[model samples]
Target: MTASSLTRPSSKASACGCGMKRRAFLRTTFAALCLPSLARGNGPSPLPSFDRCLEHFMAARNIPGGALAILRHGRLVYARGYGWAQREQQIPVQPTTLFRLASLSKPITALAILRLAQARRLSLDEPAFDRLGLAPLPGKTRDPRLEHITIRHLLQHTGGWDRAVSGDPMFMSHPIARACGVPSPPGPRDIIRYMMGRPLDFDPGTRHAYSNFGYCVLGRIIEAVTGHPYETWVRRDLLTPLGIRSMRLGRSQLRNAHPGEAHYYMADNRTAPSVFEEVPSVVPAPYGSFCLEAMDAHGGWLASVVDLMRLSAALPGHGGSLLTAEMWQELVRPPAPPVARDAHGRLNDMYYGCGWLVRPIQTPPGHNIWHSGSLPGTFTFWVILSNGMAWAVLFNQRREANGLPDTEIDGLLHLAAAHVQEWPESDEFPRYYRPSS
Candidate 1:
C-alpha cells in the first residue's frame, strides 16, 4: 500500500475534534505526551497529578501518543489526549481519536453475547460448535471435546485450544490461510476449521487458559444467531444503542484504517513479517505484522477512550440504562471450579469474568473489573473500580524504552486515583453523546 493510503481522516472541524489552534494545543505539554489536564468546564484541570504521572510515564518510554479518560458515577470527570496522533504529520491525539483496542475488544464481545442471552436469543450453556455446525477441515483426528465447548466457555477463555500447546492460531495467519486455501489471512470460520483438524490443548472448561480463537468462535456464533455479520450485529445492536458510533472492527493494514484513527508506533522501532501479503515482507508490527481483521471477535475493534468510558457510563449502577443490575452482578461471577479457585478449592483473589479480569475488594463491598489489550503498536489499560471510579489509558506504542509491559500504566493510575483530592463534578456525557432511551 502507498504512504498516501496510510493517511487519516479529513481534519475538518466536524470530522475531527476541537479545531483548536495547533500552537495553542501544544502549549499544554509538560514533557512526554504532554496533554494538559483538560476538562469540559474550562476551569482548573481536573487532575494535574494524573497529567504528571501519564506524561512522565510516556516521556520515559518515548511513546508518540496516548489518551486517558475517567468516569465517576456515569459522569465523565476527566478526558484528555496526550502527544501526537501522527508524529510526522503533527496531528495531535484528540479525545475522540480512534485506537485499535486489542484484547479490550473481548469485553465488548462478551457484552454482546450477554445481551443476546438477556433477550432470550441464546443460552450461555448451549454448545458452540454444534450451533455453528461446520465440518472440521479434513484432518486426521477431531477432538470430541470440541463439540462440548459452550458459549460460556468461549466467553471465559476456557475453550480447549491452548496457545502454549497448539500455538495461537490467531497469529499463524499465513500457514492457516495456505492450508485452508483462503486469502493471505484466514477469517474466523476458516480459523475455526483449521483448529478442527488439530487436537485440543485440553478438555473444554477444565482449566483457565486465554484463547484468542475462542472469542473468534464467539464472533461466528453472533453471526449465526443474529443473521448478520459479526461487526454489523455488534455495531447496530449494541454499540450504536449505547452512543458508541465510531467503534468498528479494524483492519490489519494501515491503508484500510478508518477515518480519524490514530497512527500506531512501534517500541524500539521493531518490525516483523507482514501477515497481509501473499509473500512475506517486513513491515511495522502495528500495521502488517499480524492480521487484525482475523482477530475481530477477540481483539479487532477500534475506539476512542471516551467511547469506551461511554460504555461504562451505560452499564448498570453507572447509568442503569444499558444492562440491568442483575446482568452486571452475573457478569462478574467467577466461572465454575478450578478456573475460579486453586487446586485446594480456595478462591483466588483475581479471576477472569466474562471478559474483564475480576478481583474482589472488601472495602468497596463489590468486585472491581478490568482488562488490558496489547498488539505490536498498541497498549491499552482500563479498570472499573468497585467504588464507581473507572479510567482508561491508551498508547500508540506498546512498550516503554526499558521494555516494561504496558500494564505498568495500571499501577500509575491506581496511585493517581488514590491521590485525587476531588474529582470534577462536570460530566462530558451531555456534551459528547446522545444515547437512545
Candidate 2:
C-alpha cells in the first residue's frame, strides 16, 4: 500500500474508547474494492482477511484469546481483539487487555542499558561485576572469566552460563531461595548471589547460548548504576517519552493480577508446588510455579498489544526511536566477526543483537528484528519487519500439544499482510485505546 493511503487524522479519544466510524468505513471500502478485482481477474486480491485467519487459527489450536495490532509504514493499519481475554469471566481480549510479555521483557531492559550507556553513566565494555559493586560469593570456585564478563557479554548472551548443562538458575527459584538463606522464592539479587558461587559453563564471550540469567544480571547492573529499580528507570527514561504508561512488571499471584489483565490457561491445568510456602499446597504454574517477580528482567512484564507497538514504533527505523542515531546503530550492529552459527556451517541468518533477535534479509534493504515470549499460560510474538512494518500478537493460553503456536501465528501474520491491497488512512489508536492506569 502507498504511504499516503495509510495516513490518518489524529484524535484525542481515550485509548479504551469504542469509536468505530473509521473502522466501519474501512471495512465497507475494503470489501467493495475486493469484489470488483475478483470478478475482473485484474490481479491478486488486496483485501487481507485477518479476522478469518485469526479465527481459524484460534479454533484449530484451541486458543481461548488473543490480541493483534499491525503497523505499516509507521502507521497503525489494523488493531483488533479476538476471542476471550478471560474465558471464565467471559471477558473479550480487546486491544487494551493486558497479557504477560514473558521474555520480551529483555528488549525493554536492553534499551534501558543502552540509554544509560548513551548518557555515559556506564560503559558497555566495563567489567560488569566491578561496576555493579559485586564480588564472587564467598565459598564458590571463582572463575577468572567472571572478571572479564562485560555488560556487552551479558547483552549478547555470551556471559558464560548455559542452560543445557548447568540448568537455568533463573528458573530454580526454590533452590536459589534455600541456598541463599532467604525465603522460598528468592528475588533477582538472591539468584545472582547463588549463580556467582557456581562455575561458568564456558569462558565468557567464547560461545553464544541464550541465557535468561544474563539479562537478570543486566537488570542488576541497571539498578546499580541508576540507584533506582530497573522498572522505575525504564518507565521514566524509555517508556514515558514514547507515550507508554500501562506496561508494568507482572505479579505471579492471580489475586494480584493487574486490572484488565487476561487470565492465563495452561493446557494441562496442572498445579505445581507453591513458590510461597505459606500459600496453598499447589498453584497454577503461571501464578506460583515459578517466581514471576524474580524473573523481572527476563520474563515478568505485562503489557497490551498497544504498549508493545509503541515500543516498536520507537525503535531505530520507525523515525521516533528514543535512542540517538549513533546509539541505535551500536545497539543493532552484530558482533564483529560474528561468533554465532549453526551446524551446517552456514552463517546463522538470525543472531541475538542487544535484546532482540536479528535476521538479515537478502531481498529487503534492512533486516528484521523480533522477539517471542512463552510461559506456562502466555505466548507472545512481536516483529519489526524490514519494510517499516511492525506487529504484535499475544495469546492467553498456549497449546502444548499443538505445533509451536508462535510460529504458526508468525506465518499467519505474513499471509494476512500479503493480501492487503490497501491500508486504512486513519489511525485508530485514540478512538479505541484506553491508557493503562
Task: Assess every candidate by TM-score.
Answer: 0.88, 0.86
For every candidate structure, what is the RMSD over all alpha carbons to the true structure, in angstroms?
A: 9.1, 9.4
Q: How does candidate 1 fare on TM-score?
A: 0.88
Per-residue lDDT of model 2, residues 1-437, tens digit only: 00000110112111112233545534533453343221111344223466655665566668889888887776666777788888987888888789999888888889999989999999888998886665555676667878999998998888889899999887787888878778888888888877888889988887888899999999999999988998898888887776678889999999999998999998778678888877896898878888889889888889988888777777778766578888876676675333576666556656777887776666645677777788889888778877788888888877676553345555555555656667777675665445544
What is the alpha-carbon lDDT of model 2 when measured against the actual structure? Answer: 0.75
User: Clashes in model 2: which pairs?
Assistant: 7-425, 15-432, 15-433, 15-434, 16-433, 16-434, 46-421, 314-321
Question: Global lDDT for candidate 1?
Answer: 0.78
- The whole-model lDDT of each prediction reads 0.78, 0.75
Off by over 4 Å in 1: 1-44, 278-280, 435-437
Which model scores highest in TM-score? 1
Candidate 2 local lDDT, residue 367? 70
**Per-residue lDDT for 331-421 in model 1, tens only?**
8888888777877999887778788788777763777787888887888876777677788888898764564435545555655665577
- The residue-level lDDT of candidate 1 at 342 comes to 77
